[model samples]
Target: MGVRYLFQIGDQIVYPMHGAGIIESIEDKEIQGKVHQYYVLQLPNKMQVMLPVGKIKNFSIRKVVDTLTLENVLHLFHNGETDRTLNFKERYKSNMEKMKTGKIQEGAEVLRDLMRMNKEKTLNSSEKSMLGNARKFLSSELGLINGITEDQAIDLLNYRIGK
Candidate 1:
């Protein structure tokens, strides 16, 4: 028997490390002689992914945040502070783990901390790439939730974080 998916076609979901996307379809495919259910997601960046329904829980796939949660995520910028004393490797690892959570608030923290770090000192190439990924992921979700363009979402985040 194939695993059932909680999400239906047209539902909006956030795939950690991949950003937000709409569920384009659910299909059954035979792999290794066994039939499995998959969710076909179309990302905002025009990327598509096929995720096995049985592995959904392991991936942290989730629905988009509601307006109130979005508000709280925005407010995190005002209340959160980055600890600059931590070593670069340690900070990067921590931020990467947070990004993997697929939570809007966690993504906000990663972006905020990285932005602050950038102002204090130049980041290494890995840090710069992580910053870009976090920003893109956050902006994608923000755009979907607020009905704004990705560029507009980036602008709003920049304004909120005082960039």
Candidate 2:
């Protein structure tokens, strides 16, 4: 199975679109006479979010990246650039989808692309928001993995990206 049940109780994980949360417990419950297994999650940053087990994959929840992987993801921001789009709505939708996918590497791509486009011209509101979200998400995960504050992680990433 792609989903691992080995996430320790109380360990923090990133659910990409949902940001950071802790795995509260693994529970076996019955719903409509069916036995359901779940990885109960408590979102520390979000209010009253208790996630069920079977839906974790559908929810895009995964363990946070390791320090080495986080380093490589930061390095990606300086490597490749994406083609800019003329349609603001389309670009926003595409970048939002990427951000929701829970792949740090892809988030780096969106960040790099948006920054490049921003330098060429001022971004529309949607694009600007997406850029901010991508940067925040990446930095938050980096913070969790590196044991640093979110602002520190963002500063380190910006310095590495030479932004």
Candidate 3:
């Protein structure tokens, strides 16, 4: 029998460290003589990942944001002050923790703060890379949101950068 799943095919979701994607299908597979259910997720960048259905809880997988929620999340870009007092190492650690949550809001905060910091002074190699990954996460989910076209999503990702 197939395992119960909270998400169905075509459901948009975020996979921590992997960015956002659509659930392409559910299938059963046997490994080491044991059967396991897996969710085949198709990422926005055309990459695909198959994760065990039973392991999603441990992995922090979650659904994409809704329109209203997205609006509020994006507001971080235009308003609010970033935590600039923390040293670079401390700030990076905090952002890394936020990224691990796989939550859209947290990802947006990371993106917003990092982008603002980048504006103040160029980030180091590691942070520049982190900023890029945050963009990938936030933009991919933004594009998956209802009424948001891919182009519009890209625009949203770039919105505060120009300010």
Candidate 4:
């Protein structure tokens, strides 16, 4: 398959399970005697990842949302639906699947549901971690989209979500 590069250096993108990041560089590296182009991203968690250009399509890599979509995504904080019927294990599995989708909207929904659950009763340790990661992912993307720091985006999310 022909390589199709979707993002350039400095472009903001989401690298699922790792939150959002900026494309730091596009470099050709020799791995196991084969040269391939890789996208090196500077992640929000202070991590860097090198993904192969040709294999990016195998993942759910996508550009960040525009301002209009950002508004709608943040809206989920207030109006998103929650699933409170599942047992603890089932709920955790379900939320993991949603987070894997790498969609900001879905992540927001997960955050919303988890927050609501915490309001009713304290979340378990695993869920608390998931909630923190989800919040980070959402806030990172928001920061990149609106040109604010992740802390500021988090503040905005909290303000909008009434946290």
Per-residue lDDT of 71 in model 3:
81
Instruction: TM-score each candidate.
Output: 0.93, 0.78, 0.90, 0.93
> Tens digits of per-residue lDDT for model 4 on 17-114?
77889999999999899999999999866788999888998879888889899887776568766777899999999889989889988898888999
Best by lDDT: 1
- lDDT per residue for candidate 2 within 23-128, as digits (tens), equals 7778778889998877776654444355666676677777887878877777666777676544777777788888888888888888888888888899888788
- Candidate 3's residue-wise lDDT over 93-140, tens digit each? 999999999988888788888887888898999999999899888888
Question: What local lDDT score does residue 45 receive in model 1, on the 0 to 100 scale?
Answer: 79
Q: What's the CA RMSD of model 2 in angstroms?
A: 3.7
Q: How does model 4 fare in lDDT?
A: 0.87
Superposed model 1: Cα runs more than 4 Å off? 1-4
Q: After superposition, how far is residue 73 of candidate 3 from its true place, in Å?
A: 0.9
Candidate 4: worst-modelled 10 consecutive residues by lDDT: 74-83
Q: What is candidate 2's TM-score against the reference? A: 0.78
Looking at model 4, the pairs that clash are: none
- Ten contiguous residues with the weakest lDDT in model 2: 42-51
lDDT of 1 by residue, 41-158 (tens): 9988788999998888899999998889988888877788778788988898999999999988898899888888888889999999999999999989988988887889889878
Which pairs of residues collide in candidate 3?
none
